[model samples]
Structures are given as structure tokens and as C-alpha cells.
Target chain A: MNLQARRTGFAVAGIAIICTAYSARLVDLHVVKHEEYARLAAEKHSFRQPIQAKRGMILDRNGEILATNLPVRTIVADASHIQNPDELASLVAARLELEKEAVLEKISTGKKYIVLKRMVPDEVAVALQNELQARKLRGIYLENDSIRTYPNGAMLGHILGYLNHERNGVQGVECTMNKELAGVDGHRFIERDRTGKEIMLYRGAEAPAEHGKNVRLTIDMGLQSILESEVDAAFDKLKPETMNAVMVDPSTGEILAMVSRPAFDPNRPGDFQPSQMKNRAIIDMVEPGSTFKIVVAAGALNEGTVTPQSSIFCENGRFSYGGRTLKDHHGYGHMDVHEILVKSSNIGSAKMALMMGGEKFHEYVRRFGFGERLGIELPGEIRGLVHPPNRWDKLTITRMPMGHSIAVTPLQITMGMSVIANGGRLMAPTVVKTIEEPDGTVFRANPPRVIRDVVPKETASFIGNALVGVTQPGGTATQARVNGFEVAGKTGTAQKVSEKGGYAPGKYVVSFVGYMPAENPRFTLLVMIDDAKVDSSVNYGGIQAAPIFSRVAERAARHLDLIPTAPSVPLQTAPVVSATTPNRRL
Target chain B: MNLSFLTIRSANRIRLRPILITVAVLSVILCTALGFVSIKLSQHAVAEEIRKTERAVTRLRSENEVLLAAVTRLSSRQHLTSLVAQSKIAANYITADRVARLTPPASDEGDSATRTALNTVPSRSATR
Candidate 1:
């Protein structure tokens, strides 16, 4: 072959080899490793942007907002994109009420994402955004965020509860209904430009956020205000260690108002002690005192152990049994069941319990919804302490009759009274009325539920009539009477139980549980004051607690727009100085 | 001489036809490329507009939420109660006698002349 022809042949072969290599590489890139390279490219430019779902609002029964969300912004810094860190930091610090040095330090890190400050109000954030735009500043961005707010402050703090730093509920209905209140968050795969701005055209695979359902409570703010004001006055005037009040509709067992003194503001939960956040109504156990007399009285009547007209000798105010002598405030020769309850005679109550027998009395106590959880919507409820008949000691039967041997929650005592007020049925108490969507569509409605019937209607009516006499002129709790309404209730004056396994001397827990317009009850209220600073003479439930009940019931009646049915009675001006026979037992 | 002239002309025509076909294909390709670029630019502009609208809507929503929260705080019972106390507002619960009912209560045991007047329903024409 000629030299020119050989060179041409070599050039042609070289060109052919080059073309084949390029073709093989193209095939590998387009087919063999396509998915891997595509994924890597996507990772470089695309991100999963989380769409936060909003938490729901808590409302009162009348549609008043109790707990709600306040929209805010979280200021973030992309230090890599920052041009003038000092200027941006100064502007942010001024707008966010933060230290300029801290913000500057954060922006100088050269990190891709740095949180400069959180919880910046919307107005301030908007102002800062405008200022940034005006100055052509970059890197600093505002992200959407929110905070839980309780507009009523500490008014219904215990019932509404508060959120923690992580936005989880810590107590009360907030904890119990958290699943319904916290919504499902969504996300989308979005591509961003080199400047860290999202490319809206390249957005893909999105799921819309599902916001939380609103929780409407059964509480009426008007009634809650009345109860809180009255309880606050009692807490100040009496200077008690602790005070609690709970008002419920006896017909439906809906909690209208519940308040505890020393309450912490939910907006600032960190400032208060854990004790201040306790809902004592369902948590604190106390010896129910004479308020428990209704249990024995009702049991005796329902069990046919004693008729309403049956008379029992009071041992002339002193009765000795099981190597102990039980006493009453005043000596009485003979009294019927009605007079026994009217006087709150410890001796008379003990005699009735003896007639009913220990097992039967315990059954009645359980039937009245004691010794178990009443299944309220609030968190951290205790079942209270009630000894079975087998656990009773020699004097347990007698001592338990007058509320000395067993401990019970304030809620139990209130529900026990509701057995009579609600015509023998024990209704399960609930604070939640309904769960609704953001658009006011109800997701779930909590209807009234009856747990069981404690006694017959006739029996309940009889016991109710007897309780009415308790607030009459000669009854133990005459001060509990509301003008133009028949107040049916019982007084409890239990000596404060000591942490060292005995009664605390010179200290008492007084309470009054009552319902007004006794013929047709509207609400059942409970007022309990623990260790009032008043003199022992004026520390009885009739004096310290019943008067508060009167004030609250009167205000609640006015709010409920209940017409006056009974004849107006004269108000008691001075405390009735009557001594309740103190029962001293272990 | 005639055959020679015809052959040359035919050869010229063949060259001219290939040139025309190349020009037509190039023009079509250029037009298609321009059209694709124009469509992409339009899409980008629309996307930018959508992004701006979305940002504005988000900002407005946030502002609305802020206003709602403020309104709730101002009208809360605690705030109103404090206001009443501070300003000495005469906000008292109306007595039962002052409340006019749509339907008068069945029993008139405690009804006075003022209560009767309050309880009595107004005629529809009068109400209108």
C-alpha cells in the first residue's frame, strides 16, 4: 500500500474507535445508571418542605374561645447566603427583641440553616420583612410558627391545662384530648434555586395539611366566672391553705364551672409550682366528713332498714359502741331520719349504718359512685379510698358512717349528692361538649351517659327532701340557703388528715355540697376550704363554706335566668356559732 | 449541441433542489426552537406570578390569625372583667323581672305588674 493510503486507513480506524467509545458511554449514562444519577441530582436541588398543621381552639359551651393559637414567625438565617451579617443581625435583633450580638454570632456561622429567634409576633415580622426588602438584605427569612394562648389567663387554667415547650399538653382536657387537637402534618418535595428560593414550577408530590379539631367544653364561662369570683373571695377572706369549687348540671353531669385556688396561669406555666397546677377537685382526697352522712341515710332508706318516718334513739347525744363513744353537738332523745340528717348528728348517722349492716352500707357507698374513678375527661383523677366490708375494723362501720374511716375525692362527694339531685342516677361527668372541625362541623359529640341507678326515684326524692331541711332555719347548713330558692345540701367539717397518719390538730377541712331550687334542680355545687385561718368556732362548713355556696348559687341562678319559685327568705348576717361534735378516730 | 445544454440544465436543477430543501428544514427547526423557548418563558412567568400570590395569601392568612387572636384576647372574660373593674363599668346581671320572655311562664304565683308587663309577648306587627 502507498504511504498516503496507509495514513488514511489509520485515521479512519481512529475515528471509528472514538465514535464507538462515545456511543458506549452515552448508553451507560442514559440507561444503565440513570436512576442513581437522577436521584443524586434531585437530592442536590430538591427538599421536603414540611407543611405544619394548626392546633385547634378550645371553646366554652357558649362558643367563647377559651384556649387558642396566636400566629407568629420563627426567624431563620442562611449564613451561606448572607451578604451583610452585621446589618441583618441588627435589624433582626431590633425587630425580634433579641440581642444583636447573639444574632450576629448566629449569622456568622456560615451554616446552611440557623435559627436566629422564635416566636416573633406577626406585625414585627412583617415590619422586618419590609425593612429587609427596602435594604436589599438577604439570608434572613421568616418561617411560619404559632404559640398556644389562653386568653382567659388563669381563670380556667386547671381545666384547660397548658402546653409544654414541645407543644404537647401537660394536664387536664388538653392532655386527654390531645390526639384530636393536634393535627396531621403534611409535606411536599420542592426544588430550590441557587439563591435558596423555592422554584414553584418544580414543586412535586404534595399532601395538604389536616388541621386539628376544635374542642368545645361543657363549661359556661358566665357560671365559671361566678364560681371563680366567689371562690376567690372565700380564699382571700378565709385565708385557707387551699380552696376548690365544682359546679355541675345534675341532670346531665356536665361540669359548668370548676376552679382551684393557687391556680397557675397556663400562658406562663414555668412561673408556678406544680402544686399550683393541680386540679384538686378530682385529685385531692379528703375525709368527706358529715357530707357522707347522706350515703348512710340513703342506704338505710333504700335498703328498707329504716323508713323515712322510722325513729332512732340518739343515746341522748352520746352513743358507745366498739369500745368508743360517739357524740353529737346537742343531746336528742329520739329523732326520725329527717331530723337526723337535718341536725348532721354523728350519733344518728352511725346508728343508721349499724342498722344497715357493714356490707350493705359499703354496697351503698359504691353504688353512690365512690371508691372508683367517675371517668371524667380531666387527667390525673384518683379513685379515692373506700374500705370494703371485709377491710373494716371493729369501729370502721360506725366511723365510716360519719366520714371518718375512709377518704374520698371532692368530686366523689359532689357526685354522691348528684345521685339524689338527679333522681337516683349517677351521671358520668364530662367537660368536653363536642369536637368540631375548623369549619364548625362537629366531628364528635359527647352525649350524657348514665352509669347506673343508685336508688329508686321515690327513695331519692325522700332523701332529697330531707337534705332540703339541712339549709332550713334549724338545719346544720342554714347559711347555704339562697334567697327565693330551696337549697338542699349537707355540710362537711372534717379535721384535716395529717401526712403522719393521724388527724392534724387545730386544722379542719370544711365543705358544702348543695343544689338550689330543690323541687327542680338546676346545678349541684361544691365548695371546699382546707385549713381556714379563721378561729375554730367560725371554721364550720355552715359558716365558712356554706356562705360562699350561697353567693355562688345566687349568682349562678341569676346567670341561668332561673325564675324565683320559693318565698324570699331573710339572709343570715352573722355566722351561726354551732359546734359540730368532733369525731376523734384513727 | 441541444443534448449538451439539457444535461447541464438538469444537473443545475438537481443542485438547486437540494439547497432549497436544506433551507426549508433549517427554517422549520429554528421556528420550533423559538417557540419552545417562548413557551418555557411564559410558563416561568406564570409560575412566578403564582408564587407571589401564594406568598401574599400566606401573609394575609397569618395577619388574619394574628388579628383573630388579638380580638379574642381583648374580648376575653378576664380582660373584660378587669376593664369593668378599672373603668367602673356598671355591668350587672339583669333581674328576672327585667327579662322579657318570648313565652310567658305557666305559673304566675310571684308575678307582679312589672313582671307581667315584661313577660307579656309583643304582637308581631309591633315587633316589626
Candidate 2:
């Protein structure tokens, strides 16, 4: 055979082989890739799934909700689906109370999705949906959404804080417990026609959302509301620039209610001043005034420098120190350590403070949890300022005894007083109690905590006795007493120091710190009214602040089922016995 | 030779190879389709149960809201004040309008008895 003929035969054979391979490859591509194509198509119809967890609820000891989420309706829009933006916006605005301009602005840009309005009423939402259909307003929509409702409105506004856009908590416990409060979001992969109506119930990939965990708080809703109402009334009557109050279990350090006035409703925070959003009970600091005398008296007893039997000569109602004149409420000539507090005698307190000196006074103050944060779960906590002994002058030492020349937040002062009422122990005040899973399942719980022991037990009794004396017939805070329960506390009326460190006259911070059932103290309450013009310039804690303390304490005692104190007797006044002169009775 | 060839041709024409190949292909395709459908149906049942559970959660939340509202109403501060006023409980300390001038002579005798009676009577702070 010729070489050319053989080469022609081999070329034909090679061409035939190549053609068969190409045909087989085409068949494989058409048939074998079917599953992949189907998967891609299914993916196009699927919606993104969000994790949704059952949010925890805040409950009272009795299981009342302080904060909880509710099912609500919202307005959603698909910009692409809207054929006429103007028509859709007009109908939605009238139904949802949103401005047409706003609604149109959201979808006019032809974005795929937009929210027109949130938290619409169920009835109004239904009507809006009906209107959308009736008017043929394409893409104007309503959808089911969840909203958080604080049943006790504005009761624990600062503690509960609130959620904003994207369901993120902004402040307070809501923000602090965002992890527990925020449920996982969910997605639905339903098959919808071009008109967006459901064709098949579901035809795409889906993963159900797991709901968020629920959080239960330690707050009692009834107690919270009671405190809130009382504070509100006091705010109206006293008209303080700002006011705050705290009630705590002295023994347990469990914070019952800590309310700061001029508060905003978390459900609608827009109506209030943003500055008022801070929880002044734990954040704002001012010279605590004479109510702080309880700390000094407790310190004196702890140091064994004085006792109820100890006596001192009050400087005839007037004594001078550090180029400043100190005055006593009464001309308590020769009085016992208890008398000094009962009468709020500044002269005696100063003389005793001189004996205490800067080092001892500063030490006691630090021990009382001053100059330290409470480490509460809430945010924006400020550690009140307590200048070190090195920073104190002779005047500061004297003034510090009576709640001046130093700064402390209202909450810290209450906690300090609680040490005396609770037999020398201080607790870490808590607002949250527990975290729970869906269907009332407890996941994490917070137990009552003892922060530390601030003083000796015997010293606490000595201070408690003197505090009780203040509510006696002629004491400085008789009005703070509960009828059935013995009330032990002190009154504070301090002149606000101006920016220049001078007394800003006529501006006063009036407050009262007291404990009920003085014999067996359960709760210690502190009421602080800032810039209080008591009784139309009523700065006296006995007259203005003490009354609120009385109402709150009495009611709280009864509500908590505490043992009431023995009634006060109109006993004959006892004559003065001891006449010790210039003793450190304060 | 012609008769034998005709007989052989008739037998070859009735050969079953092509029919068997067609049946085998059809059966494999149908079985694959059935398996795919069975898997989808089982997943659908699971998805439906999840939907039911989600609806149950929504229903429970609404029920809780109603109960919370009831509690709020009963414990309202205003309600307590009205109850207190209606009950007319007497105070433990009956302070006179004037503190400094009050004499010990004005205190009620047998104060302990009055307190016992007040405790028994739930109408007011003090038993009338």
C-alpha cells in the first residue's frame, strides 16, 4: 500500500473518534447538571433566615412583668413591587399616620425593601391593609411585628431603658441584657407570584428562627409603680430641678425601686429631655447634705470614740471653723452622741469631726462604698468622688461629717445608710433577678449578694438608735416616721456650692434617708430632692422631704408585710443629765 | 435456501433486546424521581410542625399580656389609697397639731388594747 493512502485512512478514523466524544460530553452536560440548576433556582426563591430567640421577661417576685414583648403590627413595603409610589404613599400615610413625603421618599428611589412605619395598632393595621386592597395601592403594605411594652409605664424607665430601630436596646437593663433580650430574627421562603401572593405555601430552603431567651428582673412591679407614683407626686409638689429616690433591702442589698424623677416613658422617650435619660439615683452626684450624718455617727461608734452615753457640749448653736461659721438647728447645750444627730447640731458634729480628723473620716467614708462604683448591671454608673485625706483641709474634714465638702451619688448614699440599718453589712444592690428560656424556663438567675461589711454590728446599733432619735418628738425628721413601724434616719438640707466653691444661697438639696422598723430594719430608703425650695422654699428635710419618706416607708412596710414599730408615746420630757463639755459626741 | 432464509428472518425480527433496554431506563428514572419526592415530603412535614410551634409561641405571649394587665389594675396605687381611706385605719402615733406645747397627760390610756383591736380589723390603719 502507498503511504499517502494509509495516512488518509488514519485521519478519517481520528475525526470519527473526536465527534463521538463531543456528543457524549453534550449528553452528560444536559442530564447530569439538572440537580445543580434546580438548586440554584430554589435558592432564588428562598428568603434569608434570621435567628429568633424567645426574649426573656422582667418579672417581680410574684411574677409580674416589668418589661415584656408583645405581638404588634408594622408597615413594610417592597419598593420594586410598587407600581405607583405617590398612590401607595398617600394611602399608607393616612392609615399609618406617616407623612406621605416620608413614605414616598423611602420607596421612590426604587430600593427593593423599605419600612414605612413601625408599631402600628392592630386595628389600624388591618384597616390599612383593607384600604391598600380597596384603593388598589400596589406595594403599600402591613406586616406582623413584635413590640416591647412596659406594663408599668415609666415606673423603672431608667432601669428598663428601651429598644430603638433594628430592635437594639439603647440603655439601662434593656441595653445591658441585650444578649438575652434580643431574639433571633427569622425568614420565610414562601413561593409568591409576580403579584406577590403566595402560590405554594413554601418551596425553598428554610431554617426556622430560634427565639431569644427571656430575662426576669428582681423588681416588684407593684412596688415599682408605688415608688414611681410617690416620686411623681413629690416631683410635682416639691418642683425640684431633678429628684431621685432608692429603696433597698438593707439585709439583702436587693434594690426594690430606684427612681429618678423627670423621667421619660421608655415607650416614648422622645417627649423628654435626653439629659434626663441618665439614672440619677446611680449616676448624678451632689453634696449629700446632713443626711450623711448617719455615716459619721456610725463611724464614731465603730471607732469607739463615742456611744449613745457619750456626751459633748454643742457650741451654743454657733461654732466657727475654717473661716466658716457652723450653726446648730437648736441650742443643744450639753448633749449625748444621740442628741447631736437627733437635733442635727452642726456645731457638735464639727467638734466631733475635729476629733475624727481627716484620716479617720476619709477611711470611714471609703469603707461606706464611697469613691467606688456599685458594679450594678446597668450602664452609665459613676463612682462618686470622695477626696483622699491628703486632699482635705481642716474645713473639709469638719464639713465632710455633715455630707458636704465631698460628693456621692444618691444610690451610694442609700447603700451606705443601709449598712447601718442592716447590722453593718452592705449588699451589692441588684435590679435584675434572672434570665429564662422560652415557656417559663429559668436559664440564669442572680442571687442576693453581700458586697461587704461596712461597720461593726455594735456600731450599727448605736447609729440606728441615734437615727431613731431623729424621728422622736423634737428630732430633725419627725415627719419621716411610719405610724406602725419605727423609722430611723436623718434629714439633709445642704446649700449647693457654686462653681467657685462658695455657698449658692437659696438653692438647696433637701433629702431624707431612713429605715423602717428601726428595731429590725428590712429596707432603707433615700429620697433626694434637688434644688428643693421647701414649702415654697422648704429646704427642711423634716418638713418637705420627710413626708414623702413617711408615706413611702409606711406603705412599703405594709406592702412587704414587715413588723410595724410600737407607737410613739407622749411621754414627759427627761431632764438633761450629762454636761460633758467639748466632747466628740458627733 | 429461500424457505430457510425466510424462517430465520422472522425469528430475528421478534428479538426482545431493544424493549428490555427501554424498560430498564424507564424504571431507573421513575425510581430516582420517587426517591426525590419522598425526601421532600418528609422535610415538608418537619417544616409544618415547626410552623405550628411558632404559632403556639405567639399565642402564649398574647395570653401573658392579658394576665399582666390584670395584675397592673389590681395593684394600682390609686386603688390602694381608696382602700385605705375607706378602711379608716388609725395611726400608731397620734401627733398633736402643736408639738412643743403637748403634755404627756393627753396620751390615751390602755394604748396596747387599741393596737390589738387595730391589728384585728383590716378596714383601716386604726380600728374605729
Candidate 3:
């Protein structure tokens, strides 16, 4: 071959080899490692941005907001992107009410993600963002966040619980209805620019958040305020270990007002002890004292063991049974069922319970919603301690009739009186009224529920009339009478049950459970004072708790706009004293 | 006889038609590419505008919520109660007798001074 032709052939072969090598490399990249490289590129540019759902608000029956969300921001910094750390830190510290040195220490770490401060107010965060933008600063961002706030502070704290750091409810209605209050969060696939700003053009698939539903409670803030003020005054004056008050609509079993002393502010739950967070109305168990007498009295009448006119002879204040002597506050002769209840005769109640068998009396007790949880919507409700007939000893029948052997919650005592006020039906107590969507559309409503009838209507009316005599001039609880209204109630002065054994000396749990306008009952109220540090003589339920009941009932009546059905009585003037200082009176 | 003359004429002629067609096709391709780029840039600008609008709306909504929460806090029953106790406002509960009810009591036989309504029955003059 010629020399020129040989050189041309060699150049053509070199070009062919280069083309073949390029084809093989293209195949490897397009087929073999395509998925791997694509995934790496996506990870570098795209991320899943979470969209937070707002927590629901708690509202009173009249549409007053109780618990609500205060919109906040979580200030974050990208330390790696921060150019002027000192200026950025100073601005953030001033806007967030934080220390500049601490913020500087955080930004100096050179980390990509740093939380400068959480729960910064929305206004403050906006101001900081504007400042940063005007100065052309980068790296600082505001994350959407919120905090649960109870505007009423410690008022109704026990019923409207608080949330934890993870934004989960820790107690009260918040805990019980958490599923309804916490809506499902959503997310979207998003791409960001080199500056971490979302590239809205490259946004991918997204699902919008489903916000939580609002919860409306049955509580009336008017009635609640009245109850709380009265209870607060009593707690201050009496200086009891604990005090509880609950008001309910007798016909519907709707809880109108409930207050427990030693309450913690839900907004600052961390600052209080666990004891103060207890909802004592449903959680704390105490002897129902003479309030339990209505059970045996009603049972005797219903079971035909004793007529309303049936007379039982009292042993003149003291009676011996099962090797124990039971004494009344005063000596009494023969008294009928009405007189026995009006005078709060322990011996008379025991006699009536004896007339009815133990099993029958126990049945009546359970029928009155005792020994069982009333199924309130609040969390941590207890059934309270009540032994069956088989568990009772010789003295159990006698003592249980007068509320000595068994324990019951203050709520149970109020509901037991409701049986009379509601004409024998024991209605299930409820706090939540309705669950509503964000747009004020009701999603679910809780209607009043009737559990069962404890007695006939005639028997309930008879018992109710007898209870009215309890607040009359000659009765034991005259102080419980409301002006221009007939108050039917019972006074219970129970000796506190000691941890060691029997009753504690000179320490009492005094309570008055009643309903006003006895003929057509409006509400059933209970005022309970535990371990009131007063003289034993002045610590009786009729003397101490009944007066509180009277004040609360009067105010509640006025709030309800109920006109006077009877003549007003003369107001009594009594000395107010702090029970802690027994010798000082106001 | 004239075949050689025809062949020489064809070979010497300039190919103006093919050159003109190729130039036209190249120009069309370049203009289409430029148009696609312009459309993409416009879409980016619109998306950026949309993103700014969304951010503004979110900020405004957040501000509204903050103000609402403040209003709720200030108007809460607890706050009002404290204000009343401090005597910041002169508020009082009207006595029952002073509250003139639209409907008279079912029975108005009690103390006339403490009656809920000023008149037990509707006046004929007012009704007329």
C-alpha cells in the first residue's frame, strides 16, 4: 500500500474505537446506575415539609372561649449560612427576649440547624423577620408553632386540662377528648432553593391538613364564676384541707359549675404539684355523711318497709348496736320518716335500714348512683368504695345507713340528691355539650342520658317533701334555705376517716347537698369542705357548709332569672372568721 | 450534439435553492428554542408571584389569630372579675325588683316592693 493510504486507515480505526467507548459509557449511565443517581439528586434538592394542624379551642356553653391556641413561632438559625453572627444574634435576642450571649453561643457552633428560641410571639417573630429581610440577612427563619393557653388561668383548671411539651393533653377534658381535639397533620413534597426558600414552582404532591374540632362544654361561665367566688371565700375562711363544689341541672344531668380548691393553673402546669391538679369532685372519695340518709329513707318507703308516717323510736340520742354506741347531736323521742330526715337522726335512719334488709338497702344505695362512676366526661373518675351486702359486718348495716361504713364521692352525693329532684331518674352526668368543626358546624352533640329509675315518682316526691323540711326553721339545715325559695337538702358532717384506722378525732368533712325551688327543681348543688380547722361545734355541715350553699344557690338563682315564688325571708347576720385562727372573727 | 453543452451549464450553476432552504430551517429552530425559554421564564415569574401572595396571606392570618387570642384573653371572665374587684368599672347586679320583666310573675301576691315586674298586667292604654 502507499504511505498516505496507510495513514488514512489508521486515523479511521482510531475514530471508530473512540465512538464505541463512548456508546458503552452512555449505556452504563442510562441503564445500570440511573435510579441511584436520580435518588441522590432528589435528596439534595427535595424535602417533605410538614403542615401542622391547629389544636381546637374549648368553649363555654355561651360561646366564651376557655382554652385556645396562641399562634407562635419557633425561631431557627442555619449557623453555616450565617455571615454576621453577632448582628443576627443581637437582633434575635432582642426580638425573642433572649440573652445575646446564649444566642451567639448557639450560632457560633457552625451547625446547619439551630433552634434559637421556641414559642416566640407571632408579632415579635414578624418584627424579627422584617428586620432580617431589610438588612439582607440570611439563615434565620421562623417556623409556625402555637401554644395552648387558658385565659381563665386557674379558674376551672381541674376540668380543662393542660397540654405537655409534645402538645398532648395531660388531664381533664383535654385528655379525654384528645382524639377530637388533635387533628391529623399533613405533608407535601417540596424543593427548596440554595437559600432554603421553598421553590413553589417545583412543589409536588401535597395533602392539606384536617384541623381539629372545637369542644363546647355544658358549663355556664356565669354560674361557674358564682360558684368559684363562693367556694374561694369559703376556702379562705374555713381553711380546709380541700374544698369542692359542683352544680348540675337536675333534669338533664348537665354539669353547670364545678370547682375544686387547691387548683393549678393549666397555663403553667409545671409550677404546681400533682395534688393541686386533682379534680376532687369526681376523684376524691369521702363519706357522704347524713346525705346518705336519703338513700335508706327512700329505699324504706319504696320497699314498703316503712311508710312516710311510720314512726321509729329513738333511744334518746344514744343507741347501742353491734357493740358500738351511735349518738345524735341531740336527744329525740319517736320520729317519723320525715322527722328523722329533717332532724338527721342517725338512730332513726339505722332503724329504717334495719326494717329493710341489708341487701335491699344496698340495692337502693347503688341505685342512687353510688358505688359506681357516674360516667362524667372528665378523666380519672373512680367508682368509689362500696361493699356488697355479703361484705358487710354486723355494724355495716347500721353505720352505712348514716354514711359511715362506705365511701362516696362528692359528685355521687349531689347526684343522689338529684334522684329526688329529677323525680327518681338517675341521669348520667355530662360536661361536654357539643363537638364542632372550625366553621361552627356541630359534628357531634352529647344529649342528656337517663341511666335508670331508682324509685317511683310518688316516692321521689315524698322524699323530696321530706328533704324540704330539712331546710326549714325547725330542721337541721335551716342555713341552706334560699331567700324566696324552698331549699330541699341534707347536711352531712362526717368524721374524717384516718389512714391508720377508724375516724380521725375532731377532723370533719362537712357537706351540704341540695336543690332549690323544691317543687320544680332548678339545680342540684353540693358544697363539701374537707378537714375544716374549726371548733367541732361550729364545724357541723348545717352550720358551716349550709351557709355556703345558701349563698351559692341565691346567686345561681339570680343568674338563672328565676322569679321569686315565695316571700323573702329576713337575712341573718353571722360573724365571719378564719377557721385557721380560731379566736379571730371578722 | 448539444449534450456536452448542457452538462457544462449544469455544473457551473450556483446551488442557491438548497442554501436558502437550509438557512430558513435553521432560523425556525433557533426562534422556537428562544420562545420555549421565554415561556419557561414567564412561568417561573408567575410561580414566584403566587408564592409571595401565599406567604402574605399566611402572615396576615397569623396576625389575625394573634390579635384574636389577645382579645379573648383581655375579655375573659377571669380578667373581667379582677377588674370588677379592683373597681376599674362601676358594675353591679341589679336588684330583682328593679329588673322589669316582659312577662308578669305567675303569682304576684308577695311583697309589692320586691315584685319582679313594675306592673302585674299589661296597661290598656299601651295596648291600644
Model 1 ranges off by over 4 Å:
A1-40, A574-586, B1-28, B95-128
- TM-score of candidate 3 chain A against the true chain A: 0.92
Q: Mind giving the per-residue lDDT tens digits that candidate 1 earns over B1-128?
A: 45775675466455777788899899899889999899889989999999999999999988888899999999999999999999867687676557786766455457544445677778899999
Model 1 chain A worst lDDT run, 10 consecutive residues: A577-586
Instruction: Put down candidate 2 lDDT per residue, A87-149, tens digits, no spaces.
Output: 878878877788889888888878766877777766677677777888776675556666777
Chain A alone, TM-score for each of the models? 0.93, 0.83, 0.92
Write the candidate numbers in order of decreasing TM-score: 1, 3, 2
- Give candidate 2 misplaced runs (Cα > 4 Å): A1-45, A49-55, A77-117, A123-142, A186-208, A499-501, A535-538, A568-586, B1-128
Ranking by DockQ: 1, 3, 2
Worst 10 contiguous positions by lDDT, candidate 2 chain A:
A577-586
Q: Which has the greatest lDDT?
A: 3
Q: Sort candidate 2 into its docking category.
A: incorrect
Task: At residue A385, give the lDDT of candidate 2.
Answer: 86
Residue-level lDDT of model 3, residues A1-586, one tens digit each, is: 5888989998998998898889888888888889888778777878878899988999999999999998999989988778898998888888788899999999999998899888888888888999999998889988899999999999999999999998899999999989999999988889978777888878988999889999999999999999999988888788888999999999999999999988889999989889999999999999989999999999999999999778899999999999999888899999999999999999999999988989999999999999999999999999999999999999999999999989999888988899999999999999999999999999999999999999999999999998999999899888888888989999999999999998899999999999988989999999999988788878888988899999988999899987778789975654444685542211
How displaced is residue A367 in candidate 2, in Å?
A: 0.4
Q: Which candidate, 1 or 3, has the higher DockQ?
A: 1
Query: What is the descending lDDT order?
Result: 3, 1, 2
DockQ of 1: 0.68
TM-score of each: 0.89, 0.75, 0.89
Off by over 4 Å in 3: A1-41, A97-99, A574-577, A580-586, B1-32, B104-128
How would you encode candidate 2's per-residue C-alpha lDDT over B1-128 as one tens digit per residue? 45775676566585578788888888888888898898778776776677667656854655565455556545544444555668854334323332243232333465744344445446665446
